[model samples]
Target: MEFTAEIDIMPLDALLDPQGKAVSGSMKNLGLSEITNVRIGKHITLKVKAKDKSEAEAKVDEACKKLLANQIMEKYSFSLKELVA
Candidate 1:
């Protein structure tokens, strides 16, 4: 089976996001101050061939934990969808 995976990695709520903060500051400077609570994260997409949905999900989870995210400071999430013709 073929599946598409989307992974998102972001700093934990308790962690400081300097890039997000900087962007927020810039927005305020540009008079777009209405946008608050800005957070920045990464999005990753991949296609995988697995025996089944469960196997595909397991692979994606491993990828997230091993390479997609830094478990110490960032939390990760992923979604998997089977591809149909």
Candidate 2:
């Protein structure tokens, strides 16, 4: 069977997000000061081949831990959906 994985990776809340902060600062200049504390993150989509949901999840989790995310600075989460075709 095959599945699709949607992954999100973000910096730890305790860590500073320079890109997010920069964007937030610009929001004020753009007359959108109401937006604050904006946090930036990444979204990834990939296909996995596995016999079952659990197996697909395990592969996606491993991919995040081993390649997609930096555990020391970021956290990751993913959801898997079975592919219809």
Candidate 3:
């Protein structure tokens, strides 16, 4: 079976995100003041061949934990779905 994984990686709450803060400041300067506490993150999409959905999900989680995100300073989330032929 083929599966697609959609993932999001973001800095941990305890860590400071300079890039996010920079973007937020820029937004305010651009007159978009309603937005606050803006944070930036990464999105990743990949296709995987697995025996089943459960296996695919486990692989995705492992990838996120090992390479896609820094567990100490960042957190990750992912969803897996069977790919349509």
Candidate 4:
């Protein structure tokens, strides 16, 4: 079976995101004062071939932990869906 994984990786809440802060600050300059505390993160999409949903999920998790995300400063979450057709 083929599965699609949608992953989101973000800096830990305890850590300050400089890029997000910069963008948030710019929002005010653009006359959008209502927008605040903006956070920047990464979204990754990939396809995995596995025998079943459980196996696909495991592969996605492994990829996130071992390659996609820096476990020390960033956290990640992923959802898997079976691809039809």
Candidate 5:
């Protein structure tokens, strides 16, 4: 079976995000003051081949823990969808 993993990686709430703050400041300069406390993150999409949903999920989680996300500074979450055909 083939699965699609959609992952989101973000800095922990306790951490400061300079890029997001920069963007937020720019937004205010552009007259979008209502938008504040912006935090930037990463989104990743990948396809995994496995025998079943559980196997695919495990693989995706392992990938996230081992390489995709930094456990110390960032947290990651993912959702898997089975691909048809």
Candidate 6:
């Protein structure tokens, strides 16, 4: 079976995001003061070959923990879907 994983990695809410703050400040300069507390995160999409949905989920979780996300500062969430062709 083939599966597709859609992952999102973001800084922990307890931590400050300098880039997000900078963008939030810029929003006012652009006369978009309504947009505040801007946050930036990363989205990743990948395809995997697995024996089943559970296998695919485990693989994606392992990938995020081992390589994709920094568990100390960032948190990750992913959704998996089977690929039909």
Residue-by-residue lDDT tens digits, candidate 6, 1-85: 9999999999999999999999999999999999998889999999999999999999999999999999999999999989998
Better of 1 and 6 by lDDT: 6
In every candidate, how many clashes are there?
A: 0, 0, 0, 0, 0, 0
Worst 10 residues of 6 by lDDT: 32-41
lDDT of 3 at 10: 90
TM-score of each: 0.91, 0.95, 0.93, 0.95, 0.95, 0.94
Query: What does the lDDT read for residue 54 in candidate 2?
Result: 95
Range of the 10 consecutive residues with the lowest summed lDDT in candidate 1:
28-37
The models' CA-based lDDT, in order, is 0.91, 0.95, 0.89, 0.95, 0.96, 0.96
Better of 3 and 6 by TM-score: 6
Superposition error at 71 for model 4 (Å): 1.0
- The candidate, 3 or 5, that scores higher on lDDT is 5
Q: Judge candidate 4 at residue 50 and give its lDDT.
A: 97
Residue pairs with backbone atoms closer than 3 Å in model 1 (clashes): none
> What lDDT score is found at residue 48 in candidate 4?
99
- What are the runs in model 3 whose C-alpha is more than 4 Å off? none
Assess candidate 3 and give its lDDT: 0.89
Weakest 10 consecutive residues of candidate 5 by summed lDDT? 21-30
What lDDT tens digits, residue by residue, belong to model 3 across residues 56-75?
98899889988999899889
lDDT value, candidate 5, whole model: 0.96
Of 1 and 2, the candidate ahead on TM-score is 2
lDDT of 4 by residue, 1-85 (tens): 9999999999999999999999999999999999999989999999999999999999999999999999999999999999997
